[model samples]
Target: MGRNVRKRRSPLAVRAIAASAALAIGGGGLVWANFYASAHEENSSPNTTKAATAQVATISCPDVGQKLTNVPNKARGEVDGELATLDQQITAAYQRLATTRDAQTRDASFVQNAILGPLKNNRSVIIDRIKLEISRVGGNAPSSLDGLSSCTGTPASQTNAGWGNNGQNNGGQNNGGTASPAPSPSASASAGGQQGGGQQTGNGGQAGNGPLAADFVDITKVQANVPRKARTRAGGSTGTFTTSCGVNANKKFNTDNVIVAPGVSNGAHHLHDYVGNQSNDAFANNDTFAAAKTTCANQGDKSTYYWPVVRIQNGTQDFDQNNDGGGKEGNVGQIQQVKQAQIKFVGSAKSQVVAMPKFLRIITGDAKTTTNGLANANAHWSCTGFENKVQLTQQYPICPRGSTVVRTFAFQSCWDGVNIDSANHRTHVAFADAQGNCGNGFKAIPQLTMRLVYGFRAPTLQNGQIKNAYAVDGFPEQLHKAATDHDDFINVFDDNLMNKMVNCINKGQRCK
Candidate 1:
């Protein structure tokens, strides 16, 4: 393996570290450094200071949506609108925080007084509106929601710590008792951008938000961590159903999320690559989906499949760069087209699968996992050739020359057998347990698994500078962490096609 021995950090990384140190000293003492040292004592690399630090990076707010599980259907629309407002509030505050680094360095309390204080007040009012909406519809609103109004600054280290380092120490250098050499500058240049010269500034990449150098790991050094599973039982749904949906080659893109924030444009706060249904948007309804044409080869299936668009931050600007969910919100780059997208439905290991109800909505992974913690985080990033050997949940893999980046998602496979949708947009479907058994009252449904491959040059990290940095579009406050990567699906399969899929799986036959 080639190695780049340059020890100099990038200008942006240097400035971030200096600003963080100044903020730490001006705000209180050396608390930020001490905290980061203690937290990452096991794998403290030379680039530790460049990682997401607490003092200067991004804002952290409580995820209110995750706490609202029982919102009444009658009030769900209003509540979702309020929730989107809350997100907007956080995004605005984060932008302020990013632009006021100098102020934070001068006065530690500037963030608290000028930014977080006003943000808390704004969120409190929004939370109150949500509470009133729920109560007006005869639902019990949780008083504890008031506690979620307050926001805090998150250390970059804490945000990056969502996924532990798979027992490899010092940035995967100690794996197999061999120190993995950094990618050579020439090799890094081949990935995209000029080596070490054309990289973006700020803590992250072009948009200046995130996906820090610490957010990537050398895939070759990772050990095979996928666990072995038992064989399917005698009555297991052993078959598979494949749907050929063209990768968004036509560039169906939007920032709307009809399931979570209906009737609201830019609800997702990030651009999404869409396939399947052609009429999917914030204003789309069940009727709209049913009547929509599909990109899938199967005309009977109009299911909508979408996920956050990945961008190459090599100083390129997309059309949305000037729009709300685009550059104005810190997502700036050229959106990379997905090279391949494989949508497959498979049977459960324990029993024959049942058909998913029409309009059944399912979201795999959490778009706000940075601040929401890992309760619903399900991101799995890997390189094409090394997928079976290793999978990453929090870190983006730095693939070798022959490999490309891959994102895999195994959506929830069990349904409640009642509502096609839920208040929080998650309760209607649940993931099967380790034994492939659904919880009581839930029935087995064909699990949707997506494998999306991007053939862009793999990004390289050298001296704390990420060259040709690429990140998934996400809420501004979420900072484009790999853990925040997510996918959305809404089943619109016709009755006949749905039955065909069920039969194909239950009968242990693979069909397209």
Candidate 2:
């Protein structure tokens, strides 16, 4: 509601309290329990610890320092321009998300403090009245709805865009260039009622990273799981891939298959800028998975499943064939953009990665700013060292010396095993990060993929594209809550205090 100028912070500052202080908002109602009380954090009992240990693994990326050509060509300009576009898209998503949060706040406030009170005293009467109201409102229970198991919510088999195990891939082409109809008022009533009357307590949205949680194979696992024949390009059969990230592998000599060049001087560049780097032989010719692992290892820790990912697409084609449950597909669609790569991380969490690719684009500059990839173009994460370059995803360099670098106050974090509700049946890795905690290395997470798609899709739809399309759809609801909450937190959240909290998570003290 109130306005404040957003600025980027140092990586260390974001990592300082990224674990505990990070707050996420979802439609089931804003509750802090889901973010903090996750499976990864609490290790109270020996039994739980053993169970948790089974889910964690450590792998090495010895190729971390691999060097690639570090040419100073103007192509980097094109990449930066593309990245700027993505930033605009992402910024737009955040804005839309803010709007959704406001609506949700109003909607939720209406439900919790307004509608809920009148129904509290007379339980049976309320249920009867509500049921009648639902019928009158055209949200009647189906003829076959009677005697159904509470879990099934229907008496007989029903057909819909059911979210089964392969829900991710199924939502394909659902974004067919045309703006899908916003749910009708009746449907909205049904969704709202489901959020309210039904067992509003389930794992639907709570699942790790939404839909992609279960199918999320570690980048190390992607590299490790390579079939003997699949690893060799000679087979050229376009080997079958078992992992989700492997969807990008296939037979193409595309960026998914390329590697980061070895050497510290290969100076990190935005994955978006890699096409230019590759043209100059600055991009590594090593295997793609190998480079990803190497980048992960260099960041410290050997856990293959924890590394954060930064994804970018070159156009409007679906880079990832397997959406599973995650509604991330095609180039930048209506609900989400940068599919699988916008994720940024802090601390020693880079080990969980699996695989990623690079994307290329063309960026023509304005009157004064030219798309000339000069060394001093004033790009964020534009430093001489490789370390400086790797942080490109987080920092946005100001184009002109006197102009402002559009900073954003957005953050996303995810953990394994936390479920939102029953209907939201999917493993979820929560998305949490905020400009407020940017100083903790918000820009330090190594980006892994930059893809090229072939069409133009609205980025706003991509951010809010819930798979069910029936229950949870649109950005205005959840995004609004998250932004408002974050804005409030930034205004009041003490940086020093948050730093201490993050230190506790890092030291494993907070979890213990």
Worst 10 residues of 1 by lDDT: 26-35
Misplaced by over 4 Å in model 2 are 1-12, 15-175, 178-180, 192-512
TM-score of 2: 0.19
Native-to-model Cα distance after best TM-score fit, residue 248 in candidate 1, in Å? 1.0
Give RMSD to native, each candidate: 11.3, 26.5
What do the candidate models score in CA lDDT, each in turn?
Answer: 0.69, 0.19
Position 485, candidate 1: lDDT:
87
Model 1 pairs whose backbones collide: 52-156, 52-157, 53-156, 54-155
Instruction: Evaluate model 2: give its lDDT.
Output: 0.19
- Stretches off by above 4 angstroms in model 1 are 1-58, 160-202
Identify the leading candidate in terms of TM-score: 1
How many clashes in each candidate? 4, 93
lDDT of 1 at 328: 80
